[model samples]
Target: MEENIDIEQLRIPEALTGPEAADFLRVVEISRLVRMHTWGNDELAYTAGELLAQCHDPYEWNVMLIARVNGVIEGCAGIAMPLDDNTELAHVTLDVLPQAEGRGMGRKLLEAAEQFVRGENRKSVLVETNHAASALAAAANEAEQIHPTSGTGYLPLSSREARFAFSAGYELERVERFSSCAIPLDEALIAQNMEATHAPHRSKYRVHQWLDACPDRWAGDIARLEQCLDRGQSPGHGDWDIAKLREAEEFSALTGRRTIVTAAECVADDALIGFTSISILNHRQDVAFQDETFVELEHKGKGVGLRIKEANMTKVMREFPEVRTIYTWNAPGNSQLLEVNAQLGFISAGITAQWRKDFNAY
Candidate 1:
């Protein structure tokens, strides 16, 4: 009976129960191995702990589905809803056991995820894969044609799995570079010159850490940040929104991790003028991800961006001693941010390219 098992015989579990989580971990490990075998890249493989941390959070609007046959897990798939603003799109991320390859189980699991998205009235789906999983990528491409939406894949700046995304009908959209830099925390504090440098005209803002209870304030700031994302950069496959930001914040709080958010505001006007954030991941306990840094256009060109980044880095060094390295990604053309990071001592480490494809074109 096991030998004759068909895709229909495979059970697709809706929720990631405890046992299912363990099984999913095993499946992920196997999938990672297959990825390495195909592309000779170990970075494509994710540890079981990392997978759990990403999918088990309640604040994350992630739908995890597992394919099982006769009680043995064989595959896993998940879709993360956009966190800050664009909830209409569901990002597809999936994996399957090596033995299950060439079978139709991957397609079935993908169909299930698509159905879930349609039920939620989502407009599109997005995914990133590596070359080792060409079969899986092919399945996704076929599904994209049936669904008709924008799908994208990218060469991960630091992973081998990105090659698979290239074969799955995803085109190169943009190139992004990842780099790390160390800040000299022990340096003597420069005298705070209220008027000594290229400071903004109206200055009344202070840097603050986001707390669990400040949902309303955080949500408002996230909304403003979303606007900044839209204005500062062109819209990508997935966009940001307030709901997504709330979900991300809730997830971080539940996991006991800290997301350092610094904002520059007008003191007399009491308006949020600029913002930036660094998410500390537990997987790489010694590293912090400098994410989603943005300043309003009106607030740019002044020294607010540098001031906020410097203040935030100083606070991070003092508060999180375990974090020895900070990593961030910037679009290839973003010279402005590059200058700020360079001044802070960040150096180039690697590059990742964004790839996208419109299903309608295919």
Candidate 2:
């Protein structure tokens, strides 16, 4: 919408197979980095081939766009349409160089992404924005940041991304806090925590871990656990659907991701009760992510979550020695897991707010 700014659709390989995908992947990698920069974490990056697999993934078809002003790719956008469930919903994301902020570039890129999503007959679209809470909360909007809704919410209106989303009539649906811990691979500290965690639950459960795929023994029970991930979540989300459920097939589609899953099994029954996973790409091993860490409802207070996380983080310490820090997200309402993360030395790093805009409502 702004002069000198041009948003053009960038076509990834129509048939994203074979050597020709290499050229397409290079562009994708560049675009993904532009988005990652807004996270303010340099160690966060995606490999060209990994992102290539994502672009042409079978579970969902993703659309990419590049925004330029004077012929420089300063921003990019991605639109995804799911094939399994929630077909009426589209997910869109716009990323711009930090230096390129405040020039109406993000709003322009978002508009371009929305136009593409609308073309697919989507009824609703979801987007997420991340801002450093401490940084912004301290700057100004402290009171507004303390509030939960858009007019005054966790996301600072002073932020460029927040301004664009709120001005565009996007509703703040959910606010999630991002936390991180610097891992020195301190064996004694980890051992102490694991010992204390095992003190109460040792007689009932034992810890086990796997490299990538979820083991056959744990798959079914884990599926049951995953189903309740957002069961009693806070209300800011739009029309709920079964689409958020993670299935085994989805894991297979993430061929480029390496998942380190740690679980606690009942010693007597061999049922998987608690589990945590840290997934990362092999090419970018300096950083890893906390995928999912859940303990079954009945077994929650028995320290299962703590032991599993400790075991998995300890595994990262032993195996991936180069990894400096691990990042994880939790809702402000999730006091249980938040306490676990705090005990694990994960301080608040940033907050990512999920916002939704309904095309049909308006």
Could you say which candidate leads in TM-score? Answer: 2
* Local error of candidate 2 at residue 139 (angstroms): 3.7
* Per-residue C-alpha lDDT of model 2 across residues 205-249, encoded as one tens digit per residue: 988898776666666766655655545432222333333223443
Candidate 1 global Cα RMSD: 7.9
Give the C-alpha miss distance for residue 312 in model 2, angstroms.
0.9
lDDT of 1: 0.61
Model 2, residue 250: distance off in Å is: 8.1
Q: What's the residue-level lDDT of 100 in candidate 2?
A: 74
What do the candidate models score in CA lDDT, each in turn? 0.61, 0.73
Q: TM-score for every candidate vs. truth?
A: 0.62, 0.84
TM-score of 1: 0.62
